[model samples]
Target: MAGSELPQEALWQRVAGRREGVLATLGPDGTPHLSNVYYLADPATRILRLSTTTGRAKGRNLLRDPRAALYVPGEDFFNYTVAEGRFEVAVASVTGEPAIDELHAVHAASGAAGDRPAFDRRMIRHRRMLVRAEITRLYGLVHPAA
Candidate 1:
């Protein structure tokens, strides 16, 4: 089957429906550090949110260099979307204030069931941070089964 661009809404739906993606950030050696991560997409704003520890390579690389790339898989191998742009790394926090709060928002948006307080505590214990990117460009192809 011939592949073509997915419609805007369909593209957003493809992105928003899934949580896993590969995030690419530039490492100190000028190499791409790709990480498999869970992300929350605000399709309306073209913003993506993710939680990470400050010490992780992806998080550390992102903090050092804001530019990044995201690849979200489609329903099958033939369909997928990529979002690319600069990202902002929120300050790592252990106070359960803004950083943990941002993580809470990401968790809530994901519709995952869990204890909020315990989640907050875990986030704090792990030196969690929030990563955000407002995509400057989006492109992908969709090929539905015949």
Candidate 2:
């Protein structure tokens, strides 16, 4: 990684460790639609994944435009990281059983532990889609020591 980019360890410790992030997607008018999203990260591939349904605003925005940014705050104040990348959308039907597991991970990462059966049903009923972001650039002042 370049000096301007976040180190591998910092990426894992801060971005991947966080349960939630603010996702900014482009609206049709080219404005940003920001929303809180529970996400899972793969430090190995530098990809961030989140769950959303096509009926939702963010999902609709992403379908129209794939450009996005994810901002994750550190455990402490005054520190955060931003990952800018293209957001890819995949519906459960295309992804199969793994989509369910991936959506569950989003809920689990968000600290939701109750009513697993109901949650599963709702996810399927809503036609849950997974959003994958491959980090093309990294920003913010989150240090590993922070």
Candidate 3:
């Protein structure tokens, strides 16, 4: 992981373009909780947004432990980036408050489309939440594992 390192800008750029990654949160027992998640990156703020259900392990883990990391793969097995960050969870709103709005933003960022009201209802029904990870550091290999 310590050879030719990618500049911070390059890391952020890859994050913004990568569609998905493996998010690792800490379980109650301090073990690693991993989940394959779709994400949207804000390179300007260094934040990554993702939507999930409260019932999911990742959601619960983030609520308990804000520390998290996202493993973003590159075009091939040789390349990858690991983004370390802290989480900020926003619960799903039942009455379409700012929480729902933020969730919608995340949905939109993912290029998903649907009826607004219906989406809000589903978000509430599923106890959906937005998990924003403010990335603190980026590291990984950008070359072949060999």
lDDT of 1 by residue, 65-137 (tens): 8889889988788889988876998864565577677788787776752676788777777777799888777
Top TM-score hit: 3
In terms of TM-score, which candidate is stronger, 2 or 3? Answer: 3
Q: What 10-residue stretch in candidate 2 is worst by lDDT?
A: 1-10
Off by over 4 Å in 1: 94-96, 108-118
| RMSD (Å) of each candidate, 1 decimal | 2.3, 4.2, 2.4
The global C-alpha lDDT for each of the candidates, from Candidate 1 onward, is 0.82, 0.77, 0.85
Question: What lDDT score is found at residue 61 in candidate 3?
Answer: 91
Clashing pairs in 2: none
Q: For model 1, what is the C-alpha lDDT against the true structure?
A: 0.82
Best of the candidates, lDDT? 3
Model 2 segments more than 4 A misplaced:
1-9, 75-77, 94-97, 110-121, 142-146
Weakest ten-residue segment in model 1 by summed lDDT: 91-100
Candidate 3 Cα deviation (angstroms), residue 3: 4.9
User: Please, what are the lDDT tens digits per residue for candidate 2 over residues 1-146?
Assistant: 22235675665567877768899998989988999988889878888889889999899998888988998887566578888877798776532367667777767876772466676677777788889888877777643451
